[model samples]
Target: MPQVFKDFAILFKYRNFLELCFAVLVSMLGFGLIIPLLPIYAREMGASGVYLGLLTSLFGMTRSITSIPGGVLADKIGRKKMMVGGLAVYTVVMFLFGVSTHLYHLLILRACQGAASGVVWPVAATAVADIVDPKDRGKAMGFFSMMWDAGIAVGPVLGGLAAAAFSMAAPFFVCSALSLASALLILKRVKETHKKSEEKPTVSLEGLSFHKLSLIGICVTGFTVSFAMGVVHPILPLFGNEVIGLNEASIGIIFGAMGVTRFLVKPISGALADNIGKKRVIVTGLAFNGVFTTLISFSESFTTIMLPSVARAVGLGMTMPSINALVTSMTTKEKRGRVMGIFSTSRNTGLVMGPLLGGFAFDALSVRAPFFICGFVVFMGALVLIATVTEVENENAEIALS
Candidate 1:
């Protein structure tokens, strides 16, 4: 544990990386505020299962569409510029979310929000890749993920309380304010990490044949994992509320528990991935995550649910930083932005389908059907990873280490 803290502490010396972390941390806090509330909010506005899934899918659809372009643009323009611009748009979208009355308004706003995120997250990840060494990339990403999850851990409780004390609209307003602050912070504090690519910034994968198999494997793994998450997101809170007799506050606490477990686990998991192997950590994590995801269906009450939920967090915490590090280690700096963009696009594509299918399963099949299906899909993804991905040296890894 001390070694983990030391490794994380070592990363703080990078000023640009630290600035990015702070910006992401603040932005995610706002993003997390809505996680447990949005579907329920849509439901209250008369969204049926399919319609609810559509709302989530619209966000993924727009995000998937924009992610590649966003990555290409980041290589051409600048990471800092793209990130700030996206955050500025997010500020507007969140405020609009506060004022939205009809379900259609949310649909449009969610799409817009997705577009902005498509720009923001991939670029930020590319920047992290640019700043860190290949060997330490896992830890760096783990710390980054930890910071993001920390905000997520706290945001739900605060959002729930804010809703209880004021109104459902209150969290959106607060989210808007935080988005504006994050944008301004990035604009002022973060440095541009990459030189503009001298070659024309086309989003082709022609030159990456050496890493092609690994890239494809990672993207597939990312898509399946995200798809499983997308399947759960719109329905999990609803399951707690409608079937388990929990209130919004209790739902928020459950979400918070998941986040807290992620926060505690990610840094150590990242370090573990560095010492062992990224592929091993990812496979183990996915299987564990899949098992717990399936188990959530059997929980009768809050206490029963918490075990699986937190265990799921542990699996994810182990999985994501390793995935980020593996992806970073697969490509040269020149193509990192576009590669990250492609990966994010793939994941978003899964997200686009998962929610719609999950909602259909929830309403059309059975309420617990999404969980069972999600588990099966994710476990298959882990198997897919074992078959396709092999850890290999990036062309520039030794050079980076030197």
Candidate 2:
């Protein structure tokens, strides 16, 4: 425990951790708050599964599609400006999401909002990776996972309760407040990693396409599963309400528990990945996750869900950090921000798609069918990685960035 505490303290010692975490918590919390509310709001507005899937997909589609450009921008302009500016747009867009008059309008806003994420995340990741040593990427990735776990833990339950108690719109407004706070924190507390005087783009040794292959595959894996996750993020609450007859508080608790399991195991997974190897960690974790996600569709009782769903969460927690560490291991300080931006964009793009696909599945098929589809995809991703996406053996391996 003391060693754990000491390691965590070292992460805090880095200024990048402070700012990067600030951005993640604020941004992810805002997004998390809105996720549970999205289905409820859509149903109230008479949206069908297809429409909701379109909406969810629109968010992912926009984000995923723009990652390469965002990566280029991080390389060209700088990480800080891109992130701060994106957050600024994010704050405004979220407020608009709350005030949206029609589902169509909300759909458009989410797409545009996805762009902000596409821009912000990669830059933030790049900034974090910029300062850390290559050998320590596994540890740095663990810290990164903690930030996400914290956001996931707080966002859904808080948003669900707020929606239950106040209104669906309440969480968005709260998210906006947090965004404003995060923006201010970035402006004040964080120092820019790249300065104009110091900005010099260097060509990476591995070349962009090949160097980032594994990471890109990880991105695709993330996106595909997230597409499945999107189905659940919005519909699960609806399932709990309309099908299972649970209250919003109950829904929040269940989702929050998923986050808790992920949070609890995330650090351990990252550590294990560091100790073992990224490839082994990823394959095993994804396999466990894939199997359990399918089981989520079968969950009729809370007791039935406890272990299986928690197992799925643990699998997810392990898979993500290992993949991240693998990617970060190949990046360099100069190209750090841009490459990271690409990684973030890729994963979030999947996130954007998940909702749209889920929404569609809910309308066209059964509410639970998408989970099955997602599980199958997760299995395929595991197979694909095992087949093709070989992990980098050497930490000092450099990729061609230009």
Candidate 3:
């Protein structure tokens, strides 16, 4: 390996990060299983469209609602212990999903699961951030994010297949088993990356509330763009079926192709974010995202969609790592968990709000409404990037050090 390549390998060689990644990947698998199954699963119990949307948003809402508290808990209790507890709760709630006979039952269970999920991700990311050197932090986080995307990608196919070949319950069962199994692995294999025994900083609601103003801007830009993009989401398969004249298989192929861009670009972008500058990567990524996102909406043919889809894929993959890495980089060791927790919460807020606005824009206007909205939002993100934030070098990470 090249010297630089060898350096990255060392970051992974630390057994604890891999343990954490394994746990996250497994948890994501369970999450992936639910994405394709949620609507149908609810419908099987007599839920209406409005009800289903509510059920869907329940998870996002809970995740958003509980994230800051989860962070506060992680900072208090420590990351590894919090992760284990969160995963255990996730497994139990998912199993409960299998036993539920009513839509409301599903909603309640899903909300609890959401709270647990909210706790796990940011804490895990912070744990990884704590252990990895600043030089390798972006690359490490990229790989972490890539694993998640890969899990979600692989999840739907397996979930859909299980739903078809065996039963709807099959996917849920598989998810539960994998998650609990991952939790055990985490408990056994992962060491505490952030030891609580260290000189723990005095917990302050004031400083611990790191990056609130910045997060507010990020959330606004995220919600505006993502909400617009989400409108096209529900319409994509519909467009393929009704207008574009494609079968389920072809639609899947196109969707899968576009999704590939996200995983492919994340790690490379992470490394780039650390190397060049976090804010620059964030701004450029959003700009690139704006162009490709526009192209995807306007694309006339399946082949044309691929062009912009690839661009959007790479853009998101790059943007996520840069944005998240930058966000994580700005805070301190003691307050890192809480900062990331709140950041993740803001993002989940966008996730819930995006679909609603996107749907309204489409039903009242046009099928392609979301794309235009997404493009506009990305432009706003670019503006936020330019006006508000400044770039900091990763190697000289003294700013983040206590």
Candidate 4:
């Protein structure tokens, strides 16, 4: 209620948070600009279903491999530097994607993109955790997620139109420009937030404490949810274009609607997580997502699909911020980057496998098979959360920019 608004108000008081939001928004805009068209573009280059899946999985593979190491660098070296370097890489990769004439070029570029993401996304998340009070972490993360989703929502529409009006490569060129802008913005405006840890930076899995168990639980949940989404990612555009006969612009609009729904839901969900139980919010939202995702498999047309698509967005909006807030609550500032990196690595590992599974299912099974399997997996993730995660109320003093 009023308390949520107050917490949100408190977030705006921090310059670092605002700067980070702006940078992320623009960068994600760049992401949105080309990602929806990527599958179709690959297909145009003579890729088959399994090959397209590999193309998507390759990005996840490189990102998964790099995420833990990137996090350690962020912890030991600095968050801002890691972010800046990653964005610079992203800018270069996006530009290269524009000029790429073959599928192999895309594969190389995707690997680079994944590596950059491994550095940028976790470090940026760690920075978000670092800048806010634990009490306000949920709302801040919601806001952060919302900003990027906003960029994603608009990007597809513009990209679709760009592809229609000019060329498929047009949107990618724009993406590169936006990525460059984002990198400069971060380098200039964002401050260093990592407090030099007295202990050496290292990741381990040997602990039996409540906090450690909870971290493991959240990681499992993150992996499951991301796996579900990953299963849908490579095939969703193909389904829309091939089955429903939607043009690129039309497909863009559908994804845009989904993104908009997620963008709107995140801040509210974050606030609710702060007030109601985080686990309660997470389980409920995930259940909603799981049901709707299953329903999407039954869709026969664009009209039938849109409802479930938006509903799925609502579930994701609720789940991600709460998950992030919970993770932030579990760690101290000194180790936050590495911990976020671990979570990202876990999620990316799922991403690595999901598309492969999805591609196999799509190629070998019914067209609806991937969606059904993904839906079941998502529902199971909700149950896993209920069984495993125990919410700990963080009582640490809030860190601030001096």
Candidate 5:
């Protein structure tokens, strides 16, 4: 126990880690503030059916398109530079979201927002990977995840209140301000993790030979989970409002409940992944998420909906840290940014497809159809992971570089 405290003390001693956590928290706060409200805003702008899904997918598509390039730039230029630029873009785009008068305006702005996110998330993840020891990566990532979830937990309730009290545009303005503040914090407090190098790190298939198969498996799982999420994202608010008869505030509470569950569970799951095995925790989480996400469709009331959302949060908390740590374990520090970029791309791919498919399903079949299909997709991903992925320890990770 004393040693554990000491370890945590040492981890916190890194100034960059603390700053990164702060940045992520603030940025996610802004992001969460807007996410639940975006679809409604679009619907109000006369977007429906496939257009609604396209609105969500455009953001993901742009992000997915830019992620690899952003990763390469992070490795080439630096993490801090990429992050600063991304935040600047976020500030502009979010404010634009406030004044968006048409579906086309939203489509353009969301695409830009995705591009900014492409730069921010993968690079920040790499920065975290750089600062922490390999053995403690899961815990470090868990802490980071906790911060993000914490922001997400609080943002929606506040956003909901602000929107109800004022107007739909209010949250976007507030989020823009928050994003600017986060950017300033990054510029002032966070140091560049990637050092300037004359000889660039070789990023080839050969370098990843040791864990190529595992990486592919992880990416596949990432896609599945994200795709499932995407399928639900655009329609959840609508479902709550139309089907479950929930108000904006009530819907916000449900979203907050999920975030709260993730915030509370991530640290514990991270510790478990480190002490037990990542694969075990990941498999368990995936199964839980698959089951509960499907159950969400059957929910008739706000209370019933919260149960599955909370359960899904637990599943995500368990899966995320382990997957992040696993990916980091499979690659060298120099190539970490690009590897993370690939991982982000995989997630974005699902993000892109999910809403598109969900929109179609929502229009064609039933509001419940997307949920059932998404649940099945996640189940298949879990099966693939169980069959193909093997746990790679921190001790063995160094050998992968050779």
Candidate 6:
């Protein structure tokens, strides 16, 4: 117990890392509060299956388009500036999301929110990479992952209870307030990490350079996982309510279960990746994600649903840290923001397509169909990763010592 406390003390010694964790925690908590309820809110506004999917896709599309620019700007301008500006926009947009009365209102607000998100996440991730050593990158990312998921795990349950006790709009109000608080926290507590430089970094796209191939594999893996998530996101609440006959609180509990499992698994998985090999952990995780996502289609009740949700969480927990660490390990500090931006763009590309296709699948076929397609797509992505990616061995050891 003393050793554990000492380890934590050492980890938190990086003040910027601690502050960034707080920022992510509050920001993600706000976002998480709305996750389970958003589809239901759209449904109440008379959105059909297709419209619901469009709402999510539009947000992703906007984020995807802006991510690269946001990354470049973070490198050029400053990470702290982008994060503060983005959070302010996010807070206002989330407030407006509560006031929206029509599907079109949601469409516009969600797109704005996505743009804001593009600025915040990639920049924040780059900032995290800035603070930690390459050897400790996996552990730092894991702790950061834990904080975000912990907030997500707790937020849904609270949001659901608030919605049930007051009104659907109540949770949105809470989300907006928390977002505002997070923005303020970032403004006051976080320091600028990116050193402003006049020279622009050039990223080459030619040949099968080890860096290029690893990046490609990471991006593809990101797309596949997010695609699966996007399909499930808009559909799951409705599925729970309509099929399982669950209430708002119950649906929140189900979503919370996944977050909880992710929170529990990330640290261990991250350590394993750091100690063993990133490729091994990433491949195994992707396999699990693909399998369990398919299994979700077969679930008929709340108890059964938790099985897949927990399994999917394990996969995410394993995949995210390794992917993040790999990306960080490959890039120089000067180019980290732009590279991570491209990384975000790749994941958002899946986010863009997943819902649009999932929506059509739900409307044209059945609720279960999207899950099957998502699973198959992710499995293929895993195969691509296996074929393309090789672990960075000696280079990482050198970085750790440096």
Give per-residue CA lDDT, model 4, range 14-131, as digits (tens). 7689889989999999899887899999999998888888888888899988899998888888899999999999999999999999999999999899999999988898898887
lDDT (CA) per prediction:
0.88, 0.71, 0.69, 0.86, 0.86, 0.83
Residue runs of model 4 more than 4 Å from their true location after superposition: 1-8, 206-210, 396-402
In model 1, what is the error at residue 13, expressed in angstroms?
2.6
Measured against the true structure, the TM-scores of the candidates, in listed sequence, are 0.97, 0.89, 0.84, 0.96, 0.96, 0.95
1 or 4, greater by TM-score: 1
Cα displacement (angstroms), candidate 1, residue 191, comes to 0.5
lDDT of 5 at 4: 40
Q: What tens digits encode model 2's per-residue C-alpha lDDT throughout 1-402?
A: 655666676476676786687668766777767666777787788887667767767777787666657666676776777788878888998888788778888888888887887777767766776666665666677777777777777788998899888987888888887777777777777777764434554333354433566666766666655655676656667766776677766766777787777777777776677778888888888888888878878877666655677788888888877776776665555555555656666566667667666777777788788778778878877876776666664443553332
User: What is the lDDT ranking, best to worst?
Assistant: 1, 5, 4, 6, 2, 3
| Candidate 5 local lDDT, residue 231 | 93
Q: Write the per-residue lDDT of candidate 5 for residues 195-300, one digit (tens) a residue.
A: 8545465545457535788888898999998898899879888888878999888888888888889988888888778888888989999999889989999999
Compose the digit string of candidate 6's lDDT tens values, residues 1-402. Answer: 653334455357676898898889998898889999999999999998889889999888999988888888888888998999999998899899888888888999999999998899888988998888777777778878887898889888888998999989888888999999998998998889878857565444432123678778788878887887788779988888887788999989988888898887877777778888888888889889889988988889888877897898899889888888887776667777778888888899888899988889988999889889888988888888898777665355444533
Q: List RMSD in Å for every model shown.
A: 1.6, 3.0, 3.6, 2.5, 1.9, 2.3
Instruction: Name the lDDT of candidate 2.
Output: 0.71
State the number of backbone clashes in model 4: 0
For candidate 1, write residues 182-300 as lDDT tens digits.
99998998889988877787666776434688789899999999899889889998999898998888888888888999999988888888889889999989988999999999989
| Index of the highest-lDDT prediction | 1
Q: lDDT of model 4 at residue 125? A: 89
Q: Give one digit per residue, the lDDT tens place, for model 3 in 226-276.
A: 454554454454445445565434454554554456666776777777778
Clashes of each: 0, 21, 1, 0, 0, 0
User: Candidate 1 — which pairs collide?
Assistant: none
